[model samples]
Target: MKQLIKNLCYPLIAVLLFSACGEEDKSISAPEIVGAKLVSFGFYVEDNEGVLDKDYVVDGPIVGSDIEMKIPSKIDKSSLIARFTTSEDNPAVTVKGTVQVSQQTANDFSIPVDFVLTNNSQNNRKYTVRIKRPIEWVKKVRFSEFQLSDAILKVNPVDDVPYVMGITNASNSENRKTVLLKYENETWSMVGDTISNGRPSDIDFTFNSTGTPYVVYTDYTNTIPQTATVQYYDGSSWVVIGRNYNDVRVSYNSICFDAMGKLYVFSMNNAAGGVVGRRLMNISTYNGGSWTTNQTMPGRNYNTYNMRSILKKDILYLGVYDYANDKGTISVYINQNGVWTTLAQGMRMDGATEINYNDLDMDVDNQGNIYIMGLERFDSGYKLVNHKYTASTSSWSIFATPIDLIGNTKYFSIGLNPDGGLSTVYNNLTTNSNSSFVTIDKESQTWTSPFIFPDILNTKADMAFASDGTGYIIYIDASKHLAIWEYIEDNE
Candidate 1:
């Protein structure tokens, strides 16, 4: 850390030397009066046409004439504009004796530069400014004990707190109960009663209009035509939805609430009402009294494996891994109005069956375009790519993916950023010697440096965002304890 000192000149020439430390030099002295003091300073990144790119303003008090600016180390500081304010109003600031204008003068700051602040073209103060990339404002990301033995995590967009739904005590199956926990004040506490007796194959939650949480899951114990159930806590006991909707046995359930607060559960075999075969997929909705079932896309024997969905306004998108034509391929179905259509039968090159497939993840942006992070066989090994579906063109194209993510990583998930940006996220827990959750923001088109988990065990991780842009990442660690990161800022 370098510091600048406020030099009080006693000679006409003001030959004062500033050290890397905060010490002022009395050697080779030649000034007699005090020069203008720089009150504030900032380094900015701008385009060639003077459009502001990024501004690195000094965060703390500027001591004397030493200004220490802190910015992210990843940002390039080679060509940058300097902006500063002087104690004297509208004083001319210069670097290396060339006349400089604040916010207009560009300089190469790969090394420390000297700025001379002149009060009236006569009295000037030489200020040495140094920049540092400080990663200390926020705490270091270290995994701590999270109480949920097994869990699915979510963050409320309104409250910005992490809400988890999973098995409370997995080691003791007799006493284990599916529950929801809210993380607040550095503690995990139960929000509602025990949801179920044991862990289900797929477990997730959604919020109703009144902000009440409603969870949906498949019954893992009943493999003899399993049952899909939805429940919510009503201040006391757990209230089950569609319990009387007849034999609604299904598995791999994912849920969400529409703007009308209607609960829509996407699963196979028409779990909400109709008892179809395991090949048919349906979207069941709860309408106050009874739950109704509607086939999402009819006549297609959709593979129910890894079934997931996302509904925004009128557009509803569903994705599943299809094993048709004796080859596993990624399949997508879309519902715009009342009509459901197939976007792609098999998302392979010309629907070829020679490709081996892994799991798939899909999300919808604000503009209703769908994105799929589908992993398939590419070249000699499996490759995962982000495919974007354009509604206007009715076509799917590959987006820029700088890294081989899904196939190479242990666990990879794609989700929409609910903080109101149309951006999507690519989060993966890498299989490195020391695993890290590498979160790639789609809009940035660059890789985000991940926080390393030194002894991470569980690759399962979930991320949620609050309204204030705070992100909470929760996962079970190698110690079978719930772990979390407040994630105030990007590591780089």
Candidate 2:
């Protein structure tokens, strides 16, 4: 009996030894990350039907300390989701913040992500991922023409063709005629016949979705009482838009088209007196059928001067200069849903007591942000001020002046850029020179160094941008010829 008990005890002792050896082998050790990779990255893009899922993968396996990604230009990069893989299973991967990638306000940006691996041990390995975008601007094409006045250039939003409108000297007669030139095959050619019925005073144009061009211009025909008639080019011939009233004078005739191909014309009228006064602003709309008569806007008092308007999405914004209270004032109005509501009225200069508001120009961005540029006479000198209206907050704030002393500026023109910013050009009367073409950086709320044209003495400068963020500038050169500077991207 004693021998049998010893044998059972020996077997039990052997089993206990095997269990101890297994526990020692299962002891935890430090985890290692031999490799890390971004599997698939994408976001949910909103579409007309619904949300569409867009997925993008890395070019290669993420093997080193850095990973690079390229985002398309002008893309709305907000709310991104990423899938990743690590050397070990179920590794922890996290982006730095609530990752929302957006290039709307900025030209480029960089984002960082982190990955950690662990295997029941205190020591762990981390890997960093970097994403970036690179962009640069290059000068592309320069085109020139001689003996052109009042030169205006516009790009077809559909086909990216450029159209130039100006007044040229008649070949035989001394009278000047209106000419429309289009850029094709790397050369400029006349679109139609040279309009010679009346002298072209002011002109404006817009394009339809299918790249059709429409233009409106004031024809100051040599007649008794001097009736200035408003005419429009209906893709063929110039036809009168409104009736030729007696002694009717139209100035600053601005025309724009909305998203629905509806045309709107804003101009200041003076009848009977045969004088051009910056007051008495009138709006005319063409509802894809026929042109309407002068629809008087609401705040047309005797003291109103320098009225300008711009249309965006179905909203009409009017900026008016009012001197009713002996001091110059600037007011902004909006016409939405057939109701003319005053968004801002009687806005006088905040710093100086006596202010002379000289010129007023208005523009709206794709995001519905409003910008009004005003040239005011202060105690020091002529100052240019920009008032920006934030649509989200429904408020206005004064932007920092790019140039304190405008030096008797004239021919002020402002337009929204393709990258959701603003570009302004003007002629300096005091210096007898043209100011540098200046642009507002929307993301930084700052002005870029004035871009000087190659020909310094250019006049009547106008600026426009294509849908792909390309910029074009047209002006009458020192030789009285039309010239254009194209801003292109250097992708290479």
Candidate 3:
């Protein structure tokens, strides 16, 4: 009995030892990684999807050039599934599930198998990184001829209030005279003579400080060859400025009232030359009670024909044409410090033979800088031309290159603003299409491309630029209607 008991004790002790050994080997360890999450996408490379660091490795051909994940040998073996989903709206790719092997002691395992990847959906992938392409330039607001009344024939006597006033014909027959139609307080009224029947050379209306009205026009109403008749608005009717005709044989004139309510009129008079057949400028001053006239332009034969006069900052800028040879010439006479001085000249095309009377144009800025635009005969055909005058050096420079901005057309008008910018309106003779508008940046010496008008045969147009650089194009509509198109911003 004692021997049997000893044998049992030994066997029991051996079993206990084996149990202790097994527990030692089963100590708890760090959890094995079973899957990966998509951390982020990498740089733009061909066919690259975002790297997955959290999802289980499902397929053999892992998407990117990098690894998915690894597994520990201690974890229970199961099917590892990885899902690749697209983020954008693409129809070519399909999301599929696959299983991949996770090796123990391996850093990150790549699926050895290869599968076709459609980048059509890869572009759809939402990445934290994105790029935007640059935008191209767009041509907006263009110029068109608004109206070409007989009044606009005298150089540039046309001035529209922009909002309410526009150009209209005084006569409706085969011979139409240009006149100004003004709308004040919602009422349309004729400001100047429609017929200008007596060959009224220049008609200018001015506003008093208190907003009263005054006018100056050349008429033969009182004299035989017709003296320049001056009229003033006394709140109701038109009254002559003085008791007698002050300006006689006035060729061209401009009227303006100063801050003190004083009336001033500058004009060109047919001069008897120390040499004959010359022209001189006569300036008239009027207070509320009296009138006076004096010769303002003193030079002899300075080509004062087709003179355009403007007042800026209490000074007068007279744009005289150099028609001594029939071609166009623009000489700027500036009134400064109580004396008149020749400020600048836009004379680049003077030597060109093809330039004609109808082709000449000129405008003066508030600083007396002259801007001249015209059509020049090029290659036996007329082409658009542009030039500028520098006030400091009294020099002229060509502001347009290639001359295609205004297109190859005839009978166009040029408009200039206080800034050096200019605009041109011309009939697109080829298509007889609507007019084309061209704008030039005198500072940058660049031109925007032609913006074609949308109408057809809107000819005999006139244009004017305002202080804000906004302009008006007045033209006679096809229905014989007066049309005004303006440049405005497009919200779209």
Candidate 4:
């Protein structure tokens, strides 16, 4: 009986030893394995049928250790669910030390997030998931106070709020006066008295660095063979800046401030004794006290249509049209040490040559790249184009996809945004299409589909940037009233 008890004890001990081994963690003896990998990743809509305009459900394969998903503009990124799968069975996925369940966890994906995955064999892998949401630019009105009879002559953007010049005398029956308007407190109101107190013909407005408004204009009612005049806003009243009127029959005139805050006015005056051109193009500069004649531009013959002069990098850029030499060539002159030099030879726009008066606009980027906005003639229709000239290479090329952005336009304005992107304010002459503002980055070849206007036409459309790099589209509306729309980003 004792021998039998001893054998039973040995069997019982064997069972007890096996139970003790089971109590130990099995993972401690786990074998090394090949690393697990991320198989797929996605974010799906809960109520896919009714929540959004369309299903934004994005699910895709993982490439290497990276994953990405693109969403529509204005979509919220703070609260997003990331559903993913792994290659191995019983895999454990964690983000910032928190265990994750497939399609069951919400995360803040405003920026890129990293994830770590572990498989049953204790193998691990890491991945980075990024969400790409395109920016949404919105357009809102900044000014709305205008009478049907009031004519919006020009809009000049200052630091934050802008200033606009208008004609209170819209018709010949009334006494005409140039009025100065200010955009402040979300609306446009009169800042001071009338500018010229006469009927202004050609108008250009700008603000100096010290926040003083200056206007260079031609008044036909007050003076015969109208002279180009400059005016400034002096706290309480609008007064003429310099009394040095050349009286050489100034017609097309513009105003610009130099790097030193000195004001310069360029005008198309009648041919004088020493000046060149069929119409003498004169450059007049104003010292703080008085205005003085600077010099006449060379090679100013046979060019009739005068665009505007813009200063970039302290260099004066003047644009004009030349028909005698080339096929509607756009002549751009840069003042280098007081000598005018031609840039990129001259760009051509065949369609503009046929018209006696055309609206061909020019703007320069911070990089000193010149851009001329005009129309190219085609058998089907006139296609809007932006002819770009690179200052570094001295080469000219048409921007990609202008036809798709503005379609066939009768008039348009092309300007570079502060972010180095190209933007257009175009009159869409397409039968069923509306006017729009399309912005395309310098690197991207295609457009991203932008703001659409309400029945904006071949009316005066100008694109300007505000102090904070915000873009504004200024145009004459259907009622012949001035309209300003600004671009704002919408992030949901």
Compare the candidates by lDDT and give the number of the best one: 4
lDDT of 1 by residue, 1-492 (tens): 122233333332253323434365437667664647777678655432343346667766567666666655456667777777777445677788898877777787756778877776477677776665453212223224334565666766456677878775455555566777788777667776678755554677876655578888766454433567678888777887754342556756778765555577877663444556654666688878678875455757746556666666556677776666567677787766556688877675432333343346676766777777655555545555667788789988776553454444434455555433322223333445344544454345554566665554435555555654455666676666667666554423
Model 3 stretches with alpha carbons more than 4 Å out: 1-160, 163-180, 183-214, 242-250, 256-291, 294-296, 359-368, 376-380, 392-394, 402-410, 416-420, 428-434, 441-444, 454-459, 467-469, 478-481
Give stretches of model 1 more than 4 Å off.
1-81, 84-100, 103-149, 171-175, 220-225, 244-248, 269-275, 294-296, 336-341, 348-358, 391-393, 405-410, 418-444, 448-451, 490-492
Give the candidates in order of lDDT, highest first: 4, 1, 2, 3
lDDT of each: 0.61, 0.61, 0.50, 0.64
Residue 22 alpha-carbon offset, candidate 1, angstroms:
43
Worst 10 residues of 3 by lDDT: 126-135
The whole-model C-alpha lDDT of candidate 3 against the native structure comes to 0.50
The best candidate by TM-score is 4
lDDT of model 4 at position 398: 77
Instruction: Estimate the TM-score for candidate 4.
Output: 0.68
Error of 4 at 227 (Å): 1.6
Candidate 1 C-alpha RMSD relative to the actual structure: 13.4
Candidate 2 lDDT by residue in tens digits, 322-375: 676577777888777667787887775577453354556777877778887777
